[model samples]
Target: MSDATTSDPGTRARPVDVSERVALLDVLRGFALWGVFVSNSFAWFSGYVLLPRAQAQALSAPGLEAVVSGLYHFFVNQKFITLFSFLFGLGFSIQLARAEARKSSIVPLYSRRLGVLLAIGLVHLVAVWAGDILSTYAVLGFMLLLFRQRSDRTVLTWAGGLLVAVPLLAPFVQHYGPILLHGAQAAAQAAKASNEIDLRAKEQLLAGLSSDSFWTAQAANARFLTHMVPQSKRLLWMASILGRFLLGLLAGRYLLLQEVERRRSWHHRLLFWGLVLGVLGNGAGVVMQRLRLAGLVDPARDPWMLAMSAVMEVGFLGLAAAYVAAFALLFQRERWRRVMQVLAPVGRMALTNYLLQSVVSLCLYDGWGLGLIGKLPPSRCVALTLIIFALQVPFSHAWLSRFRFGPAEWLWRSLTYGRRQPMRLAPGDAPASMTG
Candidate 1:
């Protein structure tokens, strides 16, 4: 009910030119990456990998860890991921425009791009980490192609329909949750009944991701992914991501970003209402989860969980929109603009950073690297996240100052276009697509 958008005539001239981008989008994306890094850090460093996969979220916490988890649940959980999905959708719109502008084929190019993304994500999931979303994004991206030529209302309707359907249909879906949960629980119990393993040692090695031998952690990861990846590919996950993509499409289709000044009034309204609705919505979801955790609500009660989750889902959508609007509005000012521009490079090289973040975090936390998984409390994880991203800020700038694309991004673009792209920044260098 709180959604609002405005299109301005003055800003409707040309589509988003990649060489000359709306710096605001880059800045927003860069900022969102940080949020994502922090959110994932909470999981990795705060004991996500330590527990049995099903029971990770079920672990109890006290004091600062609880506070941190609660805050992340309300303010972060879907907010940043929503932003990521939205940007993906927006990038698609831009890609479509660019191809059309150049009289090029859209499907073949886009398909190749998504294919490469899926490949990279698969490797990342199997070898480095199991929390990869790229493969799923690649899969859902194909679905987006079906809606591309549709009218704005059609796109919105499909997106909204999916969003609303997730919570409503979840009651039906949870018929599987209990059965699956039970099976997984039994399997876990059976696995734990091992003769050749030490419980404490196994838990420590797996939890800390520490490795006394090569491929040991990786073997554990493979086992985890066998269970985990399928769980992530569930309908709710895809629907939520797809819904945000549709919203991003709407923003891109209207070119609403082109006229930030003209749209200030709407941006202000979105900011005010977005925060109000977003907080309450996400908060309801968090409370619902907490209740379920505390045994106040039955885990098998799909209807109640679905209903509350719907509220939470809607709230996340609203809040994500509000963030975009808030950032868009701020881009028109100077007080925070200069500072925020620092992330522009990071966003510009988002792909490289995304993969870099996973590799770096795994090396720092996983048993394979520093093995400091359970050791880092929320407070220290928070600090570590800041340190990681702080280093990335300057690193991104320095890299972009000379190169046209980040290493991964460059490879992706080259494969996407079926040609070598100019990696070095030159006077005539002008990007034709959103490389990331």
Candidate 2:
């Protein structure tokens, strides 16, 4: 779909120069990871919804737990990853456009990139954590090719339709999901109670997580992944992901991010409408969940749960968009730009940092090291996440100061071309404004 195939298949794309980088993109990546990590801490490491509501609440201060639940469910969950997905699409668009502009073969290199991502994702799923999204992202990336040649208007129409439509339908999953999940949990509980396996095997394959050994962890991960990768959630999430991807693709194609100052009114409207929808939608969902938790309502019988959940889905997306708008608005100012620039290194090495988050979380919370697993409280999870990311900030700054690409990024680039990429900036090369 990209004219990346316009030139001879043997030809290579042009190399990236430091000055071509966009600090804004990097900062956004860094910012997104923080929220992404926070959202992930609970789900990836510990069960979120499956936990006893009382026990979950006990992890936080008596009253604070309610506030945390409201804030996280309404404001944080599912939002930042939406932003991350948008950014991934932006990267894909930029790569395709650059390859076409240079008249170089694109699909070979692009496919290679996706292949590496898939490989990493598999490793992440089996060996590290079964909650990996990289595999999904990489797999769906191939489908993006079908829409590559479409015009901006066509893309926007499809993107807008998806953004509005998919989320509204997510409620169907909630309606059926509980029934399906309850059945599975009942079966697992029954089996465990019957003691159908040896003690060691039982521990390894238990419903609760255990990562004490590589084989044990692998068994645990595989078991979890089976239940996690269901068709319903996968299909719906792909819809949401594609919607964001197409939106980012549209922006990247138009280079809208390059001239933020010129789009003041657009940014203002986005921030306003985005916040309005996001806050209201997610807020309503929070109220519903709260009522259900309070035993005042049967969530399934309440027809409003469907509508509320649907609104929350769209609202969360809006909140992510608002964040992007807020960042764009701030970037228009020199002073704020300077302060935010600190996140550039982290963003620039996003691949490395993301994997790093997974690795550390696995060690810290999984059975491999501390065996903390589901023991952490929600407030402690938030606190630990902050501490972990704060350390990564300075570490990223230090690593980028002496190298060009982050270690994993370098490896990915090298693997794409079947040769090692340059790892150090040239003498005259300086960090660029944007990384295209």
Q: What C-alpha lDDT do the candidate models reach, one value each?
A: 0.72, 0.72
Candidate 1 on 1-436: residue-level lDDT in tens? Answer: 0011112233322222245666777888898898888888877544554555345543437577678778878888778988888888887776676666665556876788889888988898888776788888898989988988899989988888778776667754654555576786664454455312434433644642666443776677666665454542366778888888898888787776657887788788888888888988987888887887677886444445646767877898889889899889877888777767777888877888988998888778766677776666566787888999999988988887678778888787777667787777677554323232
List the lowest-lDDT window of 10 residues for candidate 1.
Answer: 1-10
The deviation in Å at residue 308 for candidate 2 is 2.6
* Total clashing pairs for each candidate: 2, 8
Q: Indicate the TM-score of model 1.
A: 0.83
The residue pairs found clashing in candidate 1 are 209-367, 210-367
Off by over 4 Å in 1: 1-19, 49-60, 176-208, 301-303, 427-436
Reference-based lDDT, residue 224, model 2: 60
lDDT of 2 at 179: 49
Q: Could you tell me the lDDT of residue 286 within candidate 2?
A: 79
How close to the true structure is residue 104 of candidate 2, measured as C-alpha lDDT?
Answer: 65
